[model samples]
Target: MHLLRPLPQYLVSRYHGWVATSYAENSAWYRRLADDGQRPRAMVISCCDSRVHVTSIFGADSGEFFIHRNIANLVPPYAPDGLQHGTSAAVEYAVTALKVAHLIVVGHTSCGGVAGCHAMCSGQAPELEEKSSFVGRWMDILRPGYERVKDLPADQQVAALEREAVLVSIENLMGFPFVKAAVEGEQLSLHGLVHDIRAGTLEQAEDGGRRWTRV
Candidate 1:
């Protein structure tokens, strides 16, 4: 915990200082955004990983993209059982309230969730039911991807699963009524992208293609 102190203190202090200066630098734009309300053109669903930053990668400003981050950047199927659904609620707000024109599902290489899924697939991790852990349950979202690429070499397996997981998340995003309607009406577009954290490169999945090409 002592070693982690630098991050928290820097974020609360140095980062806040930077934010304050940025707000002043773009005062007019910030004021307009506040007055007219946020009208971001895109909504980014991405991992909570510190390395996978949507704004930096897309060169977006404060009001440019409404963002949602979660473990593995998943978008689960819509459920109405009154469960505490953070990601789902964010999706609803971004689509219905913000009315963003595009929704980008961003996946990254060497993700822990993807690694965990690979562990589970290889019998290296505990079973979901046996674990009784929130992370284990959440990681179930990647099970299909894990199963799909289980036979590949370890390095390739991670890449394949990560890509497949992005596709699954896109499908899940379409499960929401607001998203489906917006997309079908051509009011919104969906994009799937993978960020290779190690190489500092981004790849966008081609329309109607399973493989992603470097952007």
Candidate 2:
């Protein structure tokens, strides 16, 4: 606690403004949410990138989507090693307890994490090769993805890898027993999407991620 610092002025001011405006305007709705708890329709696994706004993209209200974010938006294969797995824990809660109807894995264009994975795998980023580099180890989850697209032209590799992140995550999500059971029971559905930042386009994966179509 001693390491914690006071909130910056700008954030404090913005929060106060929200309280005075949005919060005050929807106080009743907020109270209802607190009283009833959350019942989100979907679980969105997205990147930690600040540019990717899950709610804004779908025009969703608060409490409508259960969101979990990590580097590259990657979901590691289901490993029941009794270790700390934040993403797995979130997925378990969302699927088993909350019973969300949809599990969506979203990636985006120009993703730094995806680019780092591309660099690390192509022998271009030695610094990431170190065992101590957390980002490097996390990006290893996407090495199979890099291998799948390594033969492509250099300019096309990163974008392809970004989509691979989404595909790989969707595949891994099925590895979770609860997730699999939910899907088999017709209680859950999986989806993959990619956002093209420059073009303001969102694409959905189709035919088992072999092709993409505009959303």
TM-score of every model?
0.88, 0.97
Please give the lDDT score at residue 10 for candidate 2. Answer: 100
Number of the top-ranking candidate, with lDDT as the measure: 2
Q: Residue 130 of candidate 2: its Cα lDDT?
A: 100
Cα lDDT of model 2 overall?
0.95
Q: Weakest 10 consecutive residues, lDDT, candidate 2?
A: 54-63
CA lDDT scores, all candidates in order: 0.84, 0.95
Q: Summarize candidate 1's per-residue lDDT along 1-215 as a digit string, tens digits.
A: 45543566757897788778986788898789889888889989999888898899878988898999987888888786899999899999989988899999999987888777777767788664366878778878777777778888867888798887788888888889889999999999999988999898988888744667988
The CA lDDT at 200 in model 2 is 82
- The ten-residue window of minimal lDDT in model 1 covers 1-10
For model 2 the TM-score comes to 0.97
Off by over 4 Å in 1: 1-12, 127-131, 207-209
Cα lDDT over the full model 1: 0.84
